[model samples]
Target: MKILVYGAGAVGGYIGAHLIENGLDVTFLARGGHLKNIVDKGLNIVLSNQEKIVHPSYATDSLATLKNVKFDVVIVAVKAWQVRESATEILPYTSSSTLMISVQNGIDSPYELNDVFEARQIIPSVFRGICLVSEPGVVSVPSQCSWTLGEFQKNPTRAINSLLKPLIGSKLQLKVSIDEDIIKDLWKKLALIAPMSGVGALTRSVLGVCLEIKELRNMIEKAVEEIIVVAKSQNIILPDETLENSMGFYRALPYSATSSMQRDIEQKKPSELEYQTGAIVKLGKSNNVQVPVNSFIYYSLLPQELAARSDLR
Candidate 1:
């Protein structure tokens, strides 16, 4: 099947590399030095034990270059804030049969896609992995990665099956699952990540440091509670044990582990603050739920976020 991996950064590049390694037809849409590196020397994927390099069927920074080609599946792996713009750019290359996968961190990317594409064409997914781009065109996967996919609404099962078929038997130690209730999966991830990321950014520390301090740990707990209430306000009732489960997940992580959002903020790059922690505050207000903890976290980090985005003036 023909697939296009847009925003071929760490996540997209890693997935694209795997697909190409399995002999599937794949194209990559990336830009800047990363694009140059891939086009010149193929994409590199560094695993725990070894490294693999796979060149895609095609790689281009401009969609205009692929104007005549139609893609069967388009994986939207851009930042949460870049989803809508990416959707608009890729729309002309998709036909009625195209399946667009939303693999961003927040709960809003699918809705953002809905504005440009039909709901049936969108598959919302949650991705879990410890991966990053160590340099141009090189992705590092320190551990196994997994994806949980679910439809925004009822879609043709055959089409979904076709998309999953190539990924099933790969030697790449990747796990993929289909969830009947994907919304719950999205909220569960948000509950864990938003609090962890916000608190980590505020303190400029890793997950272990935040959890080790009494005051910061309490702040993290409160932030998680605030997200739970906000999720319920939207009629997406998370499990009663969400708080405990989230804490357990946090504790299990390596002490030095940091989130993508935290890393971006530390690098003074644009982050998903608005879509993750900030989304909680906005959703809570709209649903008449109180989320003071998240509000404080959001506002506390807004200055740095703005500065990074160059909107601080």
Candidate 2:
């Protein structure tokens, strides 16, 4: 089966490298310096214990080169802000039979993918890991994290099975569940990340640091509560212990465990503020719920995010 991994950034590069090591036919969609680095030096994944380098079957910057080639599966591993552009680029390479997987951090991506392709053809998933692009072609994944996948609605027969069949024997941890469970999964992740992201970025602190600052920790809890209210308004109810468990995660994190969003803001790079904390504010508005803390955080970070994007341009 031919697999196309759109955007060979940290998430895509890490996943694509593993698939290549497991002997899968995978191609990466990259651009400019990243694409050149991959062609010249191949892709490298550095971990705490070991480093893996793999030259994929093909790596190119242009989608036009892939005309008439139908991919069996297309993994959309771009940032939430890049999803729309990546979807448009990968459209020509997909046929009606192609399966699409969205591995982004936000909750709105599944619906966004449905706009580009059929809902049935899209599988939504949430991933956990501390990964980043250290350089042009080198990606780092410091931790091993599992992936949770499901359709927007339950399907007796899912394309996820076929998509994951190739990596079945590998060490990839993939969990499959029904639609309701997946919705809960998304909300649960949001509950953990939205607050962590808001507090982390706003305070310019890591998880451990936030744990020490009472006010920052309180802000994190407020963000979680607001998100829970929004989730319930949408009929997605998480467990009663969700908030407490989420807080426990923050408290247990290493002193230096910084969130990706926090790191991006500190480095003045574009962050996923829109879909992470911004989503909470939007949902709260629509649900007629009050998310004062999240609103403060979102608006506070907007200027930074906008400025970073402008600078990149």
**Per-prediction TM-score:** 0.94, 0.90
Q: When superposed on Cα atoms, how far off is each prediction in RMSD?
A: 1.8, 2.7
Whole-model Cα lDDT of every candidate shown, in order: 0.88, 0.81
* lDDT digits (tens) for residues 1-313 of candidate 2: 8999998888788778877877889999988887899999999888767787789999988777876799988889988888887788788888997878888887988888888898878878777656778888988766665566676656667555554667444333222233437767888988998898888898887788888888888888988998888999999988999889998876655677877778888999898899899998998898899999999999999988989989424
Name the regions of candidate 1 deviating beyond 4 angstroms: 156-159, 169-171
Report the C-alpha displacement of residue 47, candidate 2, in angstroms.
1.8
* Range of the 10 consecutive residues with the lowest summed lDDT in candidate 2: 171-180
- Candidate 1 per-residue C-alpha lDDT over 87-195 given as tens digits, one digit per residue, 9 for 90 to 100: 9999999998788999999899999999999998888989877688899989888877887788887665556665566754444556777877898889999998999
Error of 2 at 30 (Å): 2.1
lDDT of 1: 0.88
